[model samples]
Target: MSAAVPPVRKERNNMRARAALMSPALLIIGGFLVAPLFVVLVYSFLTPGTYGGVIWEWTTDAYVQFLFEKDIFDETLIFSTAYLQIYSRSFVQAAASTAICFLIGFPTAYFIATRPAAQRNMWVLLVTVPYWINLLIRTIAMLFLVRDNGPLNHLLLSWGIIDEPIHIAYTNFGVGIGLVYSYLPFMVLPIYATIERFDFRLVEAAFDLYADRWTVLWKIILPLCAPGVIAGSLLVFIPSLGAFIAPDLLGGGKNLMIGNLIAMQFQASRNWPFGAAAAMILMTIVLVTLIFYARRQGRSTVRLH
Candidate 1:
């Protein structure tokens, strides 16, 4: 052996090794995620070309166009509420989906978490089975089920639950149902993971201290499991907000959500800049939601400590 390496030299060698280990991930993120985001950001501020792509000329008209429309005759900017309505509808649908997922998923997750360890894997496998199928196939199947003459309506008629077939397909209600079906597992999995590791002793202690079920749920269980609930909510809400398949197939093109709006811009409308702007706005909303969650999580962690 030669003379021993110096401590600083050894540390430098270790850092080089770590960098080599991380280089692949760094390149992948930079190439795939960051570069695309940069392109979108640049395109959002550019003027739309005559045909489809962007012009090098810079302008904020794409963003302004969301809230204001140029009059057909005068070309004067008039306040427009149509885009706002679409955004509102998207948010409402997303929020409804999140709430519905939580309502159904929490109980299901708790049930799964409470089961014996040997059985928990089976329950989880069942929960995830539907997801293994193609989403488009499942959505189309849902459309068939909710259609006027579909089996669901036929069954309802046979049971005398209704005199006529309920119109669910190609409606907002149908969209919501599709969203819930698509993302319910996202809500369940996180909550189940959290509750699996949760200390049930705390719940028992609360009961022993004369806390009622509701009180224990509100004060102890809910608070401790808040991370899972929040995580599940984010999981459900974000995807629902940007959903394309459910809204497209189930909503029947009658209603337009943000995702649909963006798709129309790029494809039907052929306005790249506007599509980029809409995408950027959607990304901003998601980022803000994530940042808010992070800060709230940090504060809660501090409180616990």
Candidate 2:
């Protein structure tokens, strides 16, 4: 009689079939994601021509230009005084926006997450409904509201609080407000997803064992919800750092971001290679942040598990 086939043999056969079926996804990711990244890396090393195309000379001038070309910015002060200011300001603004969103979204998500399933869905809907409107429209609407003759100024004037309307339409504060408003929902949903399933019983137990609110939060709640915090920070911070449209429209180009500088390289300056380099540099910064966030979160999850 023929020897009976082993269960392990059959399982291996089935596993092979499953792997074969997943080939399409592997191919798709390779083509779309991997290829584009590979191409961009290649482009970053090429030399930019005067006519906007890249020359395959493998030069680092694009990078050197941005890093060392002080005289280009000396006239208006980008090199001497404002060289580092743009990035510093962007960092501060992005940090503030991330912090604000976290503060607001954490409690909001905590409250929503503890609700009944049906009620929780409704609360989420309320927060997400603003996203149905276009971002540009929202920015423009804010611009309209904060304009000198708009409702806010008119109201202030009617109240006799000031003789003239304050110029607020195109300022850093305006840009920050827009960034926070636009990205708030992004931050909220990620946090809500993780925190919604959060077991507050741990906190209650801590309190029962004589832990105070601060202690409970620091030891129990925060550690439990750190994944959500990391996710929210990545969501808000990455986009806020690269925010161009909001700052351009609301801040009126006065609050130009690194994103705007990258755009100008491509469009205004016709410097493809330099643009690619800037893109790569900005991407590197984002990747570093993401790596940090991921490592922190992975360790937290591992410790929790």
Candidate 3:
């Protein structure tokens, strides 16, 4: 009270207080996220132990093995496209799941968002009810429903839809269905949030200007909800790309994805370094894709503005 503090000193003290507040969060992120990522990077560059896990020696053999395999007799590396196919399959399945989620989710979200505010929570609860059940349990339930001689097939056969039961379980179709069912809630929630906050006045204005339903949807609704669509797509796509259980159970090991490949390295092949390298590759691919998408979205936003 005797001496007034300088403004700069006061600001510096405030900054220090803010930094102290943030320290816990920063420490948690560094310890959990950054530490694990750094460990993976280091392991990716290390040599694989004969039994399992990594050796201390640095080597690029893990990265090299991603696209090539050593011939047993000649001990020479030859280009192999098997891993490429697995990556491609993962991408296709992920894309298909995302597309299906979007198609089903958009209408569902729109319908929910249009509901009376008093009843909106109930609709959201219904959408999210599946989350209360474990994903593995849900997938197994799907297996029971789609398997040959299961209730669904038996019902269809009884209805005389076809002479024989269609093989839906343990196939790509089953995996796709499981993925869509698992991630549909993720796709719905974001889009619903966006739509619920949307200015219905603009829709009315479009209608006042004599815009048809299709035109308004294409020119206004879709554009306005684009952020939610992108968010939902990323939410659905990323997890679908790394999907393990659905593919493992539904694909029956015949249709292997990148997740399966990673599991095989760590579990079956006992090559931790290769597995880490594969994980790093998948992370890099996801990062690049996100960066490209972000840039494109930025440009689109600028154009709209």
Name the candidate that leads on TM-score.
Answer: 3
Badly placed stretches (over 4 Å) of model 1 are 1-3
Error of 1 at 38 (Å): 1.0
The order by descending TM-score is 3, 1, 2
Predictions in order: lDDT = 0.94, 0.83, 0.93
Tens digit of lDDT per residue, candidate 3, span 192-282? 9999999999999999999999999999999889989999999999999999999998888789889989999998899998989999999
How much RMSD separates candidate 2 from the native structure?
3.5
User: Global lDDT for candidate 1?
Assistant: 0.94
Candidate 2 C-alpha lDDT tens digits along 1-305: 22587888888988999989998998899999789878878877898778787888998876766655546645342333342466668878899999999999999988899898889999999999989999999889988998788999999999999899988878888888888988998888988998888887887799899998899988888887777888888899989998888788878887678777778777878888777787787788889988887887788778888
Give stretches of model 2 more than 4 Å off. 1-19, 70-84, 160-164, 302-305
How well does each candidate superpose onto the true structure, as a TM-score?
0.95, 0.86, 0.96
Error of 2 at 141 (Å): 1.4
TM value for model 3? 0.96
TM-score of 2: 0.86
The CA lDDT at 239 in model 2 is 92
